[model samples]
Target: MSRERRLTAGAVAVLLVALLGVAVVPGVLADPSADGPVRPGRVSIAESPAIAPEEVDGATATLRLHTRIGHAGNPTDNVSVRFRAYDAESGLLTAERTVELEELTGDRSVPVNATIEVPREGGYVIETVVFRDGRVVDRDRTRVSGLAALGTEVHFTESEAVPPLSVSVASVDEEANRTTLTVAASLTNGGESASDRLRVEVVLRQAESNIVAARQSTTVSGIGPGRTADATVEVTVPSDYNYYVDAAVYRDGVLVDTARSVANLDPTETISANMTTREVEFEVSDFAGDDGSQEERATEAAARTETATATPGFGPAVAVAALAGAALLARRRTRQ
Candidate 1:
């Protein structure tokens, strides 16, 4: 080729790489949480959203799609969340629900679960959109299947109360470094009739050692539709030690539901059950295998990129640079 043609070709390749780099460098460097990339003025998802139904009844069932949202800025305000359910195969809208939120604080991520109803068959794509000031800031979607297999589950389930079941350390008495805890399990009946008698068991374990500190079980009364009931029990445990309050509900000799709470009495070492998992951005999931965390995968990708860039003759940029250099040298040789 002529020197002008060779020189022009090299310039074009260089320009292409520069443009591609401009489009990609920001995503590579941005700090992303489990849900998505956290940016100022942009509300990001915290982690993988879950679509679950406590029970399926008749032709349709009620389900919840939980999305955790947060931001890097000083907390978010005037947020409204819209939940949309689309048919997995047909891509048609099945159901939609919107819930108004007071605020999404920056200190911690908030789980905004949308209640939606759809036919108790086929798969669905559940999407959650976060809107601030009537404009969408962030959104996430995930596929859910096995709806046809979720047979008629127990009608009675835990109430909507946060941490449906909890154990609180009672300050009534303290002797020999021991304390009493009142464990309460909340139950709500969403069925058409009264619920069946169920059993709630509250077990406490040492936070660090996981030793059984105290355990008790109580019977929760059958509740009427839209009514809530609590089964309360008292247990004693060693003071100044953290404990995990594990509450489980059972009916007809079958375990139905469970909830967990943390009672951190150790003032020096407090903990929580809400340590949300931070996932790598743009992770792929098949809903079957546990191939490891998204964050780990992202880190591995970064490591590979760094290795390629540092080593010789590995990355595309290096190969492209070599090509451009050869073209330029060839053109210069023709001129000489």
Candidate 2:
């Protein structure tokens, strides 16, 4: 063949290989096989897509959709999932998102998650499409109604340790030796729904040592959209010691957010939140003579002993048990 004809023929052969999905390696077609993330396979939808209301803002509703894409053959190229929301009445596209998919290895199925935000007034038709190498392989559609009735989740957060203690002061009494602090962590619910019974865990630590002075959990109620509430919990600790108040916000028993703030009561000492916290020390000297503190003091004197990181030489045990042991030892010595 002439040189010009040979060049044309070579170009045509390369085009044919690409069309057949064969990888040309080292100037040779290697066993008609594909390579890399761009290869296509039998991409199929294995189950019906699932849709649920995620959140609601002032005038819009957010919905989450989940799809499981399965492959029937060998490993394919990198895939993608496209979620589209269309107005049910006008058939106009409202929102769309494409998520890049991870390549399937030994796992035959990949779960894809997507969310769409639309006006909360009407119905919507959600469509899910799977694409491989820029080509649509599979598509599915589902319908959603009663957007107005979709309940939005109220997100609660604790931003600071004691942000302008909101409630009445009678719940906490400030004493000279030890004071009770009602940590009012500012929680904001930006979602469209109102929620109650949100839980917050507040821990008070001595600034000089990581020793946990008190830990308490309390519920914040009446949280509404764009409204701020307080996660208040009372923690009574030694008065002179500066304290770091740490708060953790949890939903359904799962930790969702955390925050810290300082309550520097001692002018001579400095304390900050977010530092590591440690266990308790048992001794009457630690909590002696404080009015109405006997119950909390006794709880600290429980059997479970912990090494006091801050208070060196503070023995681990109930203060009563320690005193009893000492008395027994003194009697034995006297008898001897």
Candidate 3:
């Protein structure tokens, strides 16, 4: 072959090798998954229209959250932005707002504002969530501090006789094993002003020793004046002791009032001494005396009080004994 023809054949071979290299190597020229140099859908939260690190309690403040969404490749549509403020310690939601946009062709900045009341002086968390097509695309959170300050306060005179907040142990249900107690508590806002972020706590404690056995808490939103709310809590406790159900009410993180009710679970009439076992056998007569007088029974019940290691089997046995004793006592009274 002539030199020029040979050179032409060499050039064709080099062109074929270059085409093969492009097919074998990925991302050599451009990324197929990405629309351009940047991602098609992007979201970010901005720290502008800044919130004060500390604010006065019981005051309302305007909170603004700024968000930026970018649609680089395809037109992102139907986007949502949400702002939520909550108590960082209690995890109670204080305020919330949402903004919706139809469609976005370029980068867009969306600003949302919410009026939040700082009920109590404490640390709080502000959160922002961005959603697209019902899916969360971005989330951000910041913290703020609430400071106590002198504000317009209302004082009720004793002569005025405003209804006072009250808490009561409505009912307590013992499990078959007696190891668990489900307590229903009722709270009433008797005062003239409304209460927000009210918390109710149920505690199971030994009557004589005042040792706490179990406790749980529940929260309620703003309770209007003269309104009532109910909450239930289940507590796991040690068995074979007389306990008292104590219900405590708090308004704006301050203790208001507390109520106590008796829970007699002692197998006093039948079991004279402490029994160290998974289960103890007792008779109904152990709780009552021969006279069966109300005062005598109370005295005997108090004298027989003893503390023993609680077991799963012991709770059911004690519960059974207590029920049987109550039924027998009622029957004897009827006979008289």
Candidate 4:
């Protein structure tokens, strides 16, 4: 052959060899593998609307996971799901099986099932990540709590430590046009661990009926082992009449205990309709103080003076006369 013809033939031969090598290569057209988190649109991860414990204990809990994987437009398949469980503080727990998978749906999706075991826990959070077409498509989390050991067993079971919580009219400050009452109650933790953020509620009920009159709540975060939390919460009752009050304690939104207080009405014989004013004495500790220190002399003097001035200063004679007049008025009203 001529030099030009030989050169053309060699070039064609090289081109043909390159094409043959490319054709002989392994299956490179296969789709990429799915892994990691699921991002919206890129892929869809459908997790159990709810995560729950089949059974729970200090050592382990079986958590059931329901999930789906898919893509928006294309029918996608072979999605990968990663599952994990952690304590309340978010420490990861080891799972017997870490991976789950589902086939692409007709609309491009699949379903995956997985079970997780919780080791030991104060609280546990379950997380799921769905991957579709080799990319993360969706993510979700669920929370579950373990039993905490508290001094008192209020929620775990019913017991007397669950003292009756109550509210009542302890006294009436006619001079101040206000009524004060003691909010007394007790709570015991009935758990293996201490409870935090314990809340107590006192409900003032309408006397002679079960209707709630007024509501008040108090909370103390720490209640330790075999311990009782006590307090005197006072509410100002505008009226001198008696009313029913109910009280209860709650832990983590659960009512653990409750109790009631005797309603102490104002002394009607001492309170007269004609006398528009009266005096009231509050405990020295009633005022807010860090160390329960007594109020300043000046403050006490001012409070007492204000109380004295509000009521008539009728000596023994006037008191006797007023008593007689009140008795007669009472008799007449009863007769009417």
| Deviating ranges (above 4 Å) for candidate 3 | 1-40, 46-49, 52-62, 66-71, 108-110, 147-336
Supply the global lDDT for candidate 4. Answer: 0.58
lDDT of 2: 0.69
lDDT of 2 by residue, 175-243 (tens): 335666667777777777686466788887666565677789888767878887766677776665566
Give me the displacement of residue 297 in model 4, in angstroms. Answer: 26
- In candidate 2, the residue pairs with backbone N, CA or C atoms under 3 Å apart (3 or more residues apart, or in different chains) clash, namely none
How does each model score on TM-score?
0.36, 0.39, 0.30, 0.33
In the range 37-111, model 4's lDDT, one tens digit per residue, is: 443344655445356556544345577766665557434556667777666675756563556454443455456
Judged by lDDT, which candidate is best?
Answer: 1
Candidate 1 worst ten-residue window by lDDT:
279-288
Error of 3 at 18 (Å): 29
Write down the worst ten-residue block by lDDT for model 4. Answer: 285-294
Reference-based TM-score, model 1:
0.36
Span of ten consecutive residues with least summed lDDT in model 3: 149-158
lDDT for each of the candidates? 0.71, 0.69, 0.58, 0.58
Better of 2 and 3 by lDDT: 2
- lDDT (10s digit) by residue, model 3, range 124-220: 7877777887889777787876333122121211222322222223333243223556665655556576655756787876555556767789876
State the displacement of the C-alpha of residue 230, model 4, in Å, after optimal TM-score superposition.
1.3
Off by over 4 Å in 1: 1-162, 274-336
